[model samples]
Target: MSEPVLELTGLTKTYKPGTPGAVQVLRGADLSIAPGQVVALVAPSGAGKSTLLHIAGLLDLADQGRVTICGQDMTGKSDRIRTAVRRRDVGFVYQFHHLLPEFSAAENILLPQLANGVGRSAAQARAMKLLDRVGIANRADHRPAALSGGEQQRVAFCRALANAPRLLLADEPTGNLDPDTSDQVFAAMMELVAGTGLSALIATHNLELAARMDRVLRLENGRLTEITGQQAGAGFLQSD
Candidate 1:
């Protein structure tokens, strides 16, 4: 089997450690996402789903554990190395679009490539290609405020993929949209991810969406449990 694009072992996080109101988000949680695999992480609001994603994405730290990205052990690494790894290997999408209101969709996508040292012309071309793949090419020149909810989310998807990262960490990518729009947007996002052979770990409360992925893992009591398609439920996100 191919190596996992992202791996977490013995991950533990505690907020306000040793305090009276300390909350334990993760307790030795372990997960591995194989290359080109799409895994769904289902958890309730307070079940530490966001905390897990943040740690996995290198946006936050774990009190104890290892974070390996594409074969490199990033845990306790220098800030510079961790930043480099995150820039080169991971893309992220959150529940909110968070696109720059003043920038066009294409520009929003292009800026990240530019920051990564891609030339302007090359960045523009790549942005256009991603927009086309997401079926939002026509809206490329529009600003976030001018686009519909679905279109805005599609733009965010393109932006996340702009750098061509090998791993994608999406937290409720379609959560903010209506049911119909969320379904359509998710289909487009999946097509885009598959086309690039990217490994994805997506977190969503929607059981139907979770079942569509290659595997489903539910978080409870600061641990992960493998769950089957039929086992998914609206109440599965509860914390232990």
Candidate 2:
């Protein structure tokens, strides 16, 4: 078997470490994502789901744990190395679109590639290809403000994938949209992921959406566990 695309081992995080009021968010949490797999992370608010993604994406550090991406161990790496790893191997998406209001959708995607040292012509072509994959190529010329909520989110998806990262980390990616739009946008994002053959770890409260992934994980008190149908049903009710 090939190595997994991403792995987290014994991850632990405390917000106020060494302080009297320190709150431990993760208690040796562990998870892994294989190539072409979509794993859904389901956890209640304040359950430290965001923290896990940040650490996995190298946006933040874990107090005690190891993070490996594409078979490379990233724990204790310098900020420069971490940044390079993040830029070259990881892509992140949050609940909000967070697109640049002034830049067109195509430009928003192209800029990151440029920053990664890709040529302008190749970056432009890649951006349009991703836009077309998401069924939003026509809106590529429009700025975020000009697009509908779903369209904007689709563009955001394109931007996140601009560099062809090996791993994708997303937190409540479709949380801001209406039910119909959310489903549509989520489906489009899945299509893009499938087409690219990348591994994705998406945090979502929507059970229906979670069920669509290859596996479901629950993060509670900082430990991660694979959840079954019964647990998923209970979590659905609890989150609702």
Q: What are the Cα lDDT values of the candidates?
A: 0.91, 0.92
Instruction: Rate residue 165 of model 1 by lDDT.
Output: 97
Candidate 2: tens digits of C-alpha lDDT, residues 1-240? 779999999999999889999999999999888899999998879999999999999988999999999999997789999999899999888899999999999999999999999999999999999999999999999999999999999998889999999998999999999999999999999999999999999999898999889899988778988987776666542443
Candidate 2 pairs with clashing backbones = 26-222, 27-222
Candidate 2 local lDDT, residue 153: 90
TM-score each candidate.
0.96, 0.96
Model 1: weakest 10-residue lDDT segment is 231-240
| Candidate 2 Cα outliers beyond 4 Å, as residue runs | 230-237
lDDT, candidate 2, equals: 0.92
